[model samples]
Target: MRVPTLQTSRQTLDAISTRQAEQARLQNRIASGLRVQSPGDDPAAAAQAELARSRLAHIAQDQRATQLAASVLTTADGALAQGTDLLQAARETLVAAGNGGYNLVDRQALALQLRNTREQLLKLANSGDGAGGYVFGGQGSPVAPLTGTMTPTYDPAAGTQRVGENADYEATVDGEAVFMNIPQGNGVFATSSAPANTGTGWIGAGSVVDAARLTGHDYAVTIGGTAAAPTYTVTDTTAGTAVASNVTFSDGAVIEIDGQRVQIHGKPAPGDSFGLAPAGRQSVFATLDQAIALLEGNPTNAAYNQGLERVHASLDRALDGVVLARAHVGEALRGVDAGSASNQQETLSVTTRRSGLEDLDLAEAISQLQNSQVATEAALRTYASTARKSLFDLLG
Candidate 1:
């Protein structure tokens, strides 16, 4: 393909041009530390390297999301821990109110202490993440999730905000379940005494004796017969049927019916009645409110004992709920940590693949670059020498 007019010179020039281009390409690769500069260099390796890079980008994005979720969950855990402490303080105050030596002034003071605890707990329930959003705000809320100073209603959406749209973990714990749906009794069933009864009797917070026989129905235990020969009867109040009748009773005897059992203490009047109902959700606010009311009432010793027992049981359950929510947050935190580790592992693997596909082999690249430089210099020298020979020998 040489031109007839200057075939020898043109051929020499073309040889130098090609050698120089190859030398320049090798130099750029060595300097850039990338062997595959373009698809033209190695199409298959280029495509695989691009895929690896895309995966790395996604992994980075996921890691960022995991970090954000961990932060929110950590905030939620701290808020719940503080709430548990507040509830513990309230329990102590409640116990103090039950003291017989404490007179009206003392009980009132104790009630005020409980009121303060309620206020503080309400604030904690509406805790924020320092980003103008609530830790207990559930999915989202324009206002505080738990409102109403007196009752403290849970008004937020039911679902918790998650780390991601499809993430199995929650960034925030379920505040409604923690604060508004606390179990009232021993986490199974609750018991109560009839207000009209004038007896020294008290009912214990009962547990399910047999799961297979659980009726999940309310029952009424009534004292019957003469005062000297008192007997107790169990009736299924929910189903309107007798569960047990004419059962012998003594002081603090355990009574069982429908797979549930409770011990009654003290002497119950012949007509005195006690009620047992399946455990139901009671708002933490209402539980505190009840304690405040009990102290504020300055009731008789008998009433104080029974009412305080109920409040104590309720508050304990409230505390348990908060602790449980805290545990859940801890679980989510662990999950986030696990996710971060997974992301790091994937990032490393992808980076290695991309390095294999496109990263320069420094020693080998340097060697190739040196060879190309030699080749380019040799071609240039040869072209100059040939040009000199052809001009001198042109006369020949």
Candidate 2:
């Protein structure tokens, strides 16, 4: 078959142009150190590289989240440590106050020390995590977990209120556990009780009762019996008469039978009596408060000494709560560390895969560029020499 002369020249020029374009592309890849600069260069490789890069980005984001979570938990743990110390100091102060020999002046001095401890505890409770939010307040931003005076009133109950996410991450601490779990005074009674009026000479009655002597055994007490303003009366079964003795009231009021003063509450009636015994919830704070009052020369009355014992018991419970909180913080810190490590590993893996798919091998790329350049040069030379030679020239 005879070749077309015109087509031959055109074909040579087209071949040279294609070779030059390829050489330029290869050179660019070598300079940039990228095998797949565009999807046109290697469609399958480009797709794989994109997927790997996306996975790496996600891993990085996860690592950041883990870091922030760890920071917040660490702040909380530090605050709890301070709280534990304050609680311990308060326990010791209460023990000192329970000593019977301390006079009114000595007791008042002890109350001042207790008040200082309470202030420190409040500061700890209100501690913040670098970010303007309280550590113990959970997800409730900007609100302190505990504040103001602690009081007891059944109707107007008060205590730490939870206001945050219930997820394990948010529930890293329990505010109520830290502030309200004191021995004998954890109930609504402690929260809602009215303050003692000094002028009225009445001190607040804590739920706990002090140990005292009883005149009648296996007897009953009735308050406000038979009269319009009837009240409690103690009856002696052996004597078959009203003893009117050895009964005490929670408010430091006493009654007299023979020469001995007995505690009584309200108005007394015939055959109405209550068994004398120690009573109160086991609480750490209540015990401390009682000790403070006793040290301040405030009458703990019959219930004061019993309150000191409860304070000691409450301390153990509070310490346990603090330990649990610390453990939770430690666990969260571990989890954060683990998550960060996982994210770093995942990121490294994704980056490696991405580099394999998208990065150019410099040695191979340089060889390809040289080969393409030689092909382009050879095509240009061939096209220039052959296109200029006509059929007549060939015959000559």
Candidate 3:
């Protein structure tokens, strides 16, 4: 009987201790405001919370990357905008120089202004991002890509940065594309009348009306016959040798040779030659230098007119390059904004999911904690009463 009594007491003590532990756990949950403190409490919910947290961390990292990309693109865009304005100023100067009334003094003044403009462009080309790297530097060259006023040198390689998951962006504009790579005229061929031509002969802007027929070679139209029966012949001077010989010429004649159509106007004197060559790449810096030289050279009226036309063509191409760079920058900015929006939405969803898995309901938790406290107190009181009542007391 005594053994059974002792066993019952021991069972009552174990019950009280278990109830006390339950009460303490409830209190901890209420204080911490987390229902699932460990995976042991709710394995599935804990795993879900961990996954959400991991996704949120990734989102944060990508958001930072997007912000960095946006900053670089913004800087590049601003630089390109300033470059456009500088080109416009150069164009305006060229126009002023083109005026018939402008004399040597006026031309010199314009050249000085152009020199200043070129300096500004160079500065823009070598702009930095306030960091160790250059804004326009393609791959972080050891030195500036464009230097020297008379003959600038550009040597750069392409470089890119990351903005999002599997999304890499070009933050640096291709300086070579902007400064050195420009198709001369019509992206095919360029035409120019000889400066020594005394006749009223003029070469209109030639076009690559046909690509297949074009030999991609330079040609010259030389006048040989008398003025009464003036004859023009097309010669491919690719290797100082004539490919097409003795082609007939007439006033206002449209001649198609090597896939290009060129219109000839006015008369051509003996030995007068008009040139045609494949449109090739030329640097904007070199173009500016050449323009300055032409303005200072004080060539004859006809020569000056021809030089002005060439300058206009080069300026147009450079402007196009600047516009293209700006467009690319705009696209990058839009992408960053879209990515930012996506990241925000993802962060919201993750936070909501994690909250669902881990957040506690204060009202429900408080009610359960109170109930557990009552049970714990009841168990303790019963155990105390049972312990006090010994065998002798029970028998009496």
Write model 1 residue lDDT over 151-200, tens digit each, in one string.
77888887787764247456666778989988887777889889988778
Task: Give me the runs in candidate 2 sitting further than 4 Å from their true place.
Answer: 1-4, 31-33, 38-45, 98-101, 150-172, 181-291, 300-302, 390-396
Better of 2 and 3 by lDDT: 3
Report the error of model 3 at residue 46, Å: 3.8
> Model 3 residue 197 lDDT?
85
Judged by TM-score, which candidate is best? 1
Select the stronger candidate by lDDT from 1 and 3.
Answer: 1
Candidate 3 residue spans exceeding 4 A from truth:
1-4, 43-48, 193-205, 208-215, 236-267, 390-396
TM-score versus the correct structure, for each prediction: 0.92, 0.65, 0.85
What local distance difference test score does each model get? 0.84, 0.57, 0.80
Tell me the deviation in Å of residue 147 in model 2.
Answer: 4.0
Residues 1-396 of candidate 3 have per-residue lDDT tens digits of: 232377787888888788778878878888888889999999999999999999999998888878777777899899999999999999989988878898898898899998998899998888876656667777666577676767788766755444466565555667788777877755578889877788767676567777777778889888877887777777888867765656677877888877898877777777889999888888888778878988888886656766777777778888898899799889978988888899999999899989889988889988887887888788788777766665677687
Model 1 lDDT-worst window of ten = 1-10
Ranking by lDDT: 1, 3, 2
